[model samples]
Target chain A: MDKSTQGRLEAAVEALIFASDVPVAASRIVAVIGEVMAEPAPDADAITQAVESLNARYDAQGHVLRIRHWAGGYRMTTTAEMAPLLEVFLRRERRRKLTLPLMETLAILCYRQPASRPDVSHVRGVDADYALRKLLDIGLVDVVGRSEAVGRPLLYGTTQRFLEEFGLPDLDALPNLRGIEELLSDPSFSQEKARLFMLQGLSGATEAEQP
Target chain B: MYRVKLRDFDGPLDLLLFLIQREELDIFDIPIARITDEYLTHVRRMEAVDLDGVADFLLLAAYLISIKVRMLLPKPAPEASDQETEDPRLALVERLLEYRRYKEAAERLATIQELRAALYTRGSASAPARAEPQEVLINASVYHLIRALRRVLTEAPEAPALVIRARDCTVEQQQQFVIKALTVGRDLEFSRLIRGRNRIFVITTFLAILELIQRGLVVLVSTAFDDDFVLALGASGG
Candidate 1:
């Protein structure tokens, strides 16, 4: 690649990582930078190196920035040394400690919103009355409307803050857990099966998925 | 011997179920007079019960009182010809019976939550010191049970000994220290970040790096062909 073309690729990658609120995965960085620069960076290693060089330069210059891997992907961030800047940049306030059950309930509502409390309970293998009420109290889940079935159950949905906490933009952006929709519809997927589905779906494969 | 807040009670149905459990009464053949009296007493003791939730409890109460009233009136002018020989309480009896099943189911669900929680503590013990518990949590609907379990988790009578071999260091405390250091330094090297740290400290530092990156406070950049990833944060962090 020509010197100017390589320079353009570096600038584009820098912009993408900087603009991202969460880690920008290496593959994602490669795709976005490659498209913008319109030059073949060939091989994953080539892209990886360019990204690393940029990181070195930034560190040498003491630019309150860094990229670290989390949740199986790389992301950009302001160093902990400069975490105080968040006093101003934190638009979505952090919550009180999120207990495990609270987080799971939030996940169900987030992934299967426009869903009923009973429906959520079904998938979780428990009565969700208390959990649903808790979500309501926190304002993270709301009674969006009613379900289509009899009893016209009050349906629940996740708020935007729920998405922000996971650094997800929308429901569709959430990593898939296979058979989730079917499990909600039937509420009988055993805990073992659900766990396996999440592990599998996380690998970006949808094969052998049972409804 | 204990009083639970209305918020802690879940719902009126939940309160009613709690009373049943507390009294050890058979739900299939409820002692209507005793239960009705006790339920009203609890309601009088607390004023914040939701109106709609109360209405639901009251509707069932009304049905029970009516059944007793009808059972009291003799022969009702030959029963007005439409009433069946069956006890009027059958319908309500069926409702209480049905509702009890769901209550039992909810309780069973709570047990599952507790079991799941125990599993987490076990997993935490086996994991690398730096590994925090996974982010996937038990749902909030079952959080009450989790609360109960957390109470149990802390019940392990012995406190861990505080040793300075980095054994005294907790992940939370370390996360904060690393974040503070990075924030003040503006930028730091991967090796520089781990200086004079122990193995456990190294793991936590790595996790801190991951957490910071996840939060968008760290950025990793590279040249066209380098394996050495230089970690950077915003202009104020390294």
Candidate 2:
């Protein structure tokens, strides 16, 4: 393609991603650009190349925004460096750290998609009803379908919102499940445990005064 | 009285994992006797605070003690061809290992979430329109409020008997009571609202709060304590 044609395609891709509130799929972008240009639709590869070129230009020029491929689509998001100022402007609350229960319940559903309440509960050794409901409220997990077990319980799975929120292109992008030995050896593990113990100590001191 | 905070530990397995990690014990060869003793201490602490899910911890405590007993019991004589005896701790160890894998996965997810929080998308330039005006309470579901109510109910003193009283405490009256109380102070701790009240009064007030929340007259905000929540004036409230 000529330089002007490539520039037009890049500009079109940039416009679509910038205007879209949700991520714009490559096919939708191709169709839109193809109809506007009155030519054969550009393939996914062309769109990908356009995105790469646009991102490259943005990076070379030190632009704050970048096109990110998330949840099977392209989205224009501000670079991480601008987050602090953006957060202040947005008045965003400190992101609600997922409580331990919700995190555990989410991890279980993430790995074992379409799992029932009983399945999660069996693994965690506690009723997962509360955590599951909280996750649903957070838009991370959703009822995908029903199980084929005795009572046919509702099966839950991670939602598209989950993928987007985690910045994962797909479930395949999930970090590898580290083995127990590796997790044990991780220095962060001990640090987290120590922090939890300190929290426990503070709370335990308060509890001693009660009754 | 080391009250086991439900938020800190997800469940019984989580508590067990904590004990093991604290001691740096080998997961494969957990010393059941020592771990069981430490586990019971934490369980007792949970009971002392009347935590929401102490029963789950207690159940695991029972299993741990049983394992300790089995370890103490004598083994059968070795056959001509020695058979490998199954360790009583084997099942528990496997369960712990499984739980650990997911726990680690959860941490990784948390990290991913943190990184994702930094990137601002189109609609995320401003705070997303929320159902509740309070951002903290956006994640606090009705179930969480109900759990807090459960704690209050358990702690409430029983009603006095032998008094044939009229059914004067209706939902509307309690609703007015809540609204009026909040009008005095913009925020009210739920437990404080029902403190020194009878069972009927407490139950009626709880129902009133639920109704107010449904109508967007009040919002339930989570406090530092899991068993307690704060009620604030909603967007439409007086």
Candidate 3:
């Protein structure tokens, strides 16, 4: 990693991130740079440095777009100041919130995955087909594999996009699941504490999640 | 006419939760026969409105009815012990509790979705790169199309019942009509296509639009809910 080569690597990293519409992984960037330059692949640390340097440059230059690390990869996105304008330009409907049914289905999948549709339906006491299809269409939940249960139904799991979209670093970061026994112990749990907690939970989204 | 929009009907579990809250019923020990009657009453109202996606609710109603029937039946020899003979309501209660937990979590996720929607990305680069011809449409489902169809059908003037001959508009004929309409006037409004049409004509045209979408002849585009879709020439369209 000579001074000139280091500068070229940083430039290459920037160019790669800029060209990619999806997030670019550090390992993938290293492989591409190694293949293109016909040299040894740089380590992940080098790529991280390049990203940090690029961010610093963007900050110093007051550029609206910045390379963001999300879902274990880097992608270029505009600053929060630009979100309102970009949304207008994109003509995105902000009212496309996941309905309560869809959310309930997603929540079951999130905590109990990789679960079968039957499993989810059993717990929710309703047919999960429509909700599952909608979730699959939206790219939040995916058919991970077939379960080895009685009929070997398809197992569903949350995608990496789920983590990114939900502002969770990983499945481990999901809020702790309250014990069923604890909930069942209180007779008025569902109507009282659960309802209040859900209302309070609406404020779960945090500022750190902003791109 | 008590018209209910399809969006107004949440899942059956939601309706059950609402009924319990409204009736001020006990969660742990639900009065099955009473709740079933209330739930059926709600279902009857939805049926009157002719809601399309009420099958899920109907299925739950049937299940509740069965549970209510079981409650009427005598217990099996008092079972082995109280622990062995689990209360039937116990399972239903647990299911409701679990669903309630996830419903809350989903609301939390909804906040995240709103926040994520607020965060902006670079211009065209915000779009995901696709190896295949991506599902290049908004979150518009068949439900939206159906709702549009319902609205158009309802708005169309009532055809006289005494007509000697039925106005037969085949799907194939409607397909040709749609293509011709789009070719002559690109990006035509969906409502305009079905406006002033009879019930049969409106249905056939809706089917034709779906076929055109399938064949990549035209694409449906809308930026807002309940907004009329524009039928524009697709990539493969002439």
lDDT of 1 by residue, A93-194 (tens): 222344434555665565567889777765444467877877677666788999889999999997654443344435566544434234323333244544
lDDT of 3 by residue, B49-106 (tens): 5556677788889889888877887777765566534556655665576667677677
Q: How displaced is residue B142 in candidate 3, in Å?
A: 20
Better of 1 and 2 by TM-score: 2
Tell me the tens digit of each residue's lDDT in model 2 across B150-194.
998889787788787676699999999999999898788999999
Give fnat, all candidates: 0.00, 0.75, 0.55
Query: What are the runs in model 2 whose C-alpha is more than 4 Å off?
Result: A181-211, B1-8, B78-84, B126-238
lDDT for A107 (candidate 3): 85
Here the TM-score of candidate 1's chain B is: 0.36
TM-score of each: 0.32, 0.68, 0.60
On lDDT, the candidate that comes out on top is 2
- For candidate 1, the docking band is incorrect
Candidate 1 residues lying further than 4 Å off, grouped into runs, are A1-15, A21-31, A41-112, A116-156, A159-161, A166-211, B1-8, B13-37, B47-53, B56-238
Collision pairs in model 2: none
The Cα error of candidate 3 at residue A4, in Å, is 8.0
